[model samples]
Target chain A: MGLKKISDNTYEIFEEGMNVPARIFASKKILESVEKDRTIEQIKNVAKLPGILKYALALPDAHQGYGFPIGGVAAFDMDKGIISPGGVGYDINCSVRLLKTNLKKEDILKKQKEVVEELYRKIPSGVGRGSRLQITRKELNNILEGGAKYIVEKMKMGKTEDYLHMEEEGCMEDADSKKVSERAMNRGIGQLGTIGAGNHFLEVQYVDEIFDEKVAKSFGIKKGQVTIMIHCGSRGLGHQVASDYIQMMEKEYGFQNLPDRELINAPIKSRLGKDYYSAMCAAANFAFANKQIITHWVREELVRIFPKVKIDVVYDVCHNIAKFEEQIIDGKKRKICIHRKGATRAFGPGRKEIPEAYRKIGQPVIIPGSMGTASYLLVGTKKSEEISFGSTVHGAGRVASRSEALREIKGEDIKKEMNEEGIEVKAGSWKSLAEEAPEAYKDIDEVARVVDELGISKKVARLKPLVVIKG
Target chain B: MKFKFLEHTADVKFQAFGKNEEEVFENSADALKEAICDKKKIKAAEKKDITVEGGDYESLLYKFLEEIIYLLEAEDFLISKVKEIKIKNFRLKAVLSGDKASDYNFNNEVKAVTYNEMFVKKIKNEWVAQVVLDV
Candidate 1:
């Protein structure tokens, strides 16, 4: 457990077994809290994995997860390394989407409760909740392969411009539905527009503060302008994909040699690895389609309420995923498999992956806060690419368990508190609300400050929740 | 007590107790049931049979619990009771009973079952199993 303070808000641990050093990007205060869990040990173990390049890194919001720490980020040699479902997490492509609106804060304030209620009623959420729009088995396959493009072009759900602002343009070309399991397809068929529970939410927020006027303007943001934030994933489809692949990998390659059973992986060149990657891409596509349909629903509901409101996609980012991308490593450009679990890809300016309009400013990194906290809009910086492989924290990582949160706070009380703060909140159940209380997570302001100070992702604006609809 | 929740930093963890493997597996289902909704309110209106195999007790338990999750999500079935379970060698067979999920209100969602910190074994005379679920 020997960790050296390598630089300001950066720590490194290189040990005997680890093939590469484990680096953690955290302020001193954040590092203290991070060490309280198994995050350090998990990242250290990740460093020892086969073919790991650069270093196993943890963002500021690092917390203990099943295999990889929630905020863990690592890149591996494409041919020499491995692909693990655990590294990508259970909810594949569990991501965030931001929508900019022409309406102002005052426009929503007058009808905040009605707005939240309409959204909660329109969007399908909670456990076992199916979408209002159902698709055939064949249609589900199309979505799995097409992602947001299918929803827009074939289904006529959203605009083509909508997917343009998303990562991978809302589709990962590697997706192949033939590689996905029937069980996963069955689970996804009915969940296209639904937002499954456990930290997933649709929040109506407004820009409260802007740190950089130029970047904020470029991203179509202004103080007091309203916005919609959708946080969800592939739902049961992604969950099934992860479980199916994990079990498949376990059967193919015994976990006796792995550091952790959940850390089970397959060589990148293996058939199982390629199959899992394709299946994972298919699931990620499903998630993209899920959010796209939800966006359409939100637009329909909002227009019914206020005909003048104009909402457009700001940016969308996948927090949990693995991708093969070319990056400069140790003075050499190489294609590596990068797994980002509870981390955001904050590619700096001029990276081809970023959307064309915002290429000069860099990728828009949307880091959402816990329920009833301030979310931040950030821009990726060159420093992040040089030090942490172009990644940043995803959110205010959980500080307490669900049982602890439930025992300590009542959901009704949280609702009352939020109401008193002038934020309208609606949920399917009170228990889930209590489990996701802002108290259960780290201070998002501090988490944002640490990354901004580290020069990984510079803060562009801060958004305050006005209406929250939790799944 | 059949099962009780344990502390974990980010997800749901529970430990189930029984006199043998079969009982422990049943209690584990009960734990999962409670995680989703109040089992007491669920009516055994329907029944489904589940058969799964694994290489060991741990994998067997994982498969069993994962099957229940699949039933809940894919089939929209809310399991109230583990009507019966039989473990032979590395395979498991069980009968579960519950009502449609749409007919009930779920308190939480069990996203997936993880092998992380999962165990099933005998301690002295009491059979025990520990599971951490992704929520």
Candidate 2:
């Protein structure tokens, strides 16, 4: 509760239990909503964790999650720190991908209904919806290790350009399929191209506005150009991996000294910790492979509508993940484990971690808002690395609970409203739509504005949804 | 009659009650079933037995709820109800019945059970368990 306004857009809390101060980056308006929940407390608890380097941070869209607040970021010293499943979150590599198409808004408007319907039919979505592309358990292991690269090169689902545009080249090289448990493998074998329910979606959108023309051109975007965005994770595979490791960690290292049971972790150098990292990477690779397969389907479905349509990968970003990266810690560059939950890596220009094509312009950070809202495309700034360890908010954070949204909104009514607004909407169930109504989330434009104001990630373009496919 | 959902920002929260530990565990399974689908619509066409061990009562409840998720994810079994349950020395055994998940509509995807604000306790006359599910 001992929060101090450190600067124009940052707050720091240093209490008795904290080893380092917990910092929150937000405008005054966003801070008010953040204070309404336990996000502040969660971050403070994160600050108490062992070997935490710098301070625990919450972004503008920070919201209370189970152990660590959603939109949380923290770095830990590899030697003395711990790797927590709660920090990386359950949906390992829950990410977003953008595809820039040559088609214009008018081109999509001509056959919006048919396109939406075709996409809905082609892509398996919703709870318990199995993928159409089935693979053997051995093939699933290859995907777990090979990631998007395997899908692009081996499966021939996409081109070299596809994986090149993704973070980590669409695969974490350290991913070891053997580290993944049998139960996790069973859950994932049939879920490669499926989008599970609960806030996962694929939206057909068009560029509404461009603020940085040069950067927008580099990212292959223009005013009125159509772009498709896919939002999903590794599906059941990722979920099971997190559960498997969380239980394993709890059994290996009891939570007696931890602040919360969900915050249970093992030393980074421990065998158990290394195994989790490898398993986590494997799960993340599955997500990349999953999205790649879906990309192929999306292309197949859209090409039928426009034979000449050209779709290229703009970028793909994983918000829920942990990785080892070199950062300047106390005037010396050292590799530390950075955990980003409900946050995106916004690496600035010249960072070797970025794709070669965009390395000079910084990583393309894609922030997809709730359905029917305006999403933003931003480029990372140098200030982001200095302030928030090259990270930024993921989306318009949820402000209301699912039950409250269900109680107040009707799915049929929401569909009608979206239709009137010229957005084609398709979903597996009416209840799923109601639970994710735009009103249940904070205003995305405002959330983006706060980050832009802080210079963490500068906004380049805004996208308006033309069609929404929800699971 | 046994469980009711509570409010949480980004997940599902619920509390189940019973007269004893076994009854509470059964109702908790019912609570999980209700979260996935309409339990009445699910017929108990198949039955499977589950066994799990934990360090304490709280973890025992956690593992029990997680088995429901594992069944739904790995085995494609949507547990309709818990026909029998028993807990001894931090270990649990139960008989569960349900059909394939593809047979019915799922309202939401319950990703994984969490220990965040989880509890299992007995108060004066009633046994209670609290859980928060990540969806």
Candidate 3:
């Protein structure tokens, strides 16, 4: 791959087989770490997708993944484009939600232990934990189609403000349950409201520092204020949808000469592609509802542990999912299918798609840290249009494999270290906890800084964990 | 049956080896169950019929392992033993038996079977299957 440095935080990949060049938003250190993996080649392969427009860009947290690299972003012309299941990832609509509490860090520290325990009890975690809500098959179908709006409007789980803060208002339009497979539906049964294992978590943190005070204030975050973040996705339902469609697409459009079989895709206008879009939306909806239900449980637990703690949702955004978005391409606004594999849309201020309340300040970009690191809250910048297709880093991307982490780090030692640092932890399994050790991931602050330096996303506030619940 | 877990950044990966294709398929099914929970602790107290089809050796193995994941996720049915298995052309038939998820001690969760680095081939006259499961 021919590489050229466009700026201090931007690099362009001009390779032989690429349809378009790939731009990476990372500093030299971040680039060095990624070069140790196959993420660079994966980004180059993503550039070869049909009708891939602009640049197949990777964020600062980029890491090696199956077809498309994690933290990879690309846009394709609606008609000329193709939709790949690998582009959306196995965990459809895996996202992050940040909640703001009226209390300060001092208030949380006093009740951290009790609050963490209550939360673990209220919200089931771990493998195959049954739903707390007894939803019938009919209601479950509605949720599969309705998303977060179904939980809020129909089930009365949340208020209008709660729905407003979400990426798609908790429901994705054009979600056809018929497109969802029975096997996928079967996997979803009794699996709602769970924070499944492997890198998913619920963290209680405080705004430890403010970089952009004005933007932080606009987002209802302040230095020393308490906040909570939920990191998870659609669970088995989403994975099944991806698996089902990957097989379907491979059968329909045989991948005889693709870079990888995992990169199998269908033309966006094809029947199979349309069916996949519908099913993917359905799974994304489940993710929204999953977070909403957990929010309800968190609020209930918070009130019991610390009275008068008013928790308000700051923002919720999906990191893994593809959406048909209209973006300015070659001076004309065009609808393009934006595939954000392990990336998040960083639509800058004035984008009508974002919540009106924060449209002036730009969409809130939530980048979670590893198990015991500093997470960041940033806002999209207008310059993103010229960069990563208005997409940014998802989280502290992993550099170490789970097996390596399990062999090198012990769960008990991590737990003890976090305790010493005044952070509480509850995990489903020690092995899983070890796999999620902070050392397994890249430095999140350094990752976020690259995009911030590039002016794609500007840092607002930094958060340090007080309590972490890993499933 | 012989199986060894591999390394993946995002998911659980493993490879199963056997003397022949059927043995490899059965061993991979065992590998999938092992990914979910400790195989030694599970009991084969029940039985259910299983059948699947694929175009080739890779797809056949892919679908076979996928069936095991579907059983665990959808029906909450765990597989402790493979009572029988037969492969003819591109079709595979088998019987799996186990108890409900709630009845046993389970460890990790495997969301779905992914095609990343998935393949089945006879290398050195020994059938081997590799898979990376989304966990």
* Candidate 2 local lDDT, residue B24: 90
Instruction: Rank the models by lDDT, top first.
Output: 1, 2, 3
Write one digit per residue (lDDT tens) for candidate 2, span A129-186: 7889878888888999999999999999989999999999999999999999898888
Each prediction's DockQ? 0.83, 0.81, 0.68
For candidate 1, the docking band is: high
State which docking tier applies to candidate 2: high
lDDT to native, each model? 0.92, 0.92, 0.88
lDDT of 2 at B22: 92
Best model number under DockQ: 1
Q: How well is each residue in A1-471 modelled by candidate 3, as lDDT tens digits?
A: 467999788899888788999888788888888888889888998988888998898889998888899998989888888998899998999999999999888988888888788888888888867788888878878998899889989999978799889898878997888888888888887789998888899999999999998989899889999999999999888988999999999898887778878889998889998999999999999999999999999998888877787988999999899999888887888889999998888989999988988999899999999998999999987788656778888998998888899899999999999999999999987887898999999998888787788888899999999999988
Q: Local error of candidate 2 at A450, Å?
A: 0.3
Q: What is the TM-score of chain A alone in each candidate?
A: 0.99, 0.99, 0.98
The B-chain TM-score of model 2 reads 0.95
Q: Which residue segments of model 1 deviate by more than 4 Å? A: none
Kindly report which residue pairs in candidate 3 clash with one another.
A148-A170
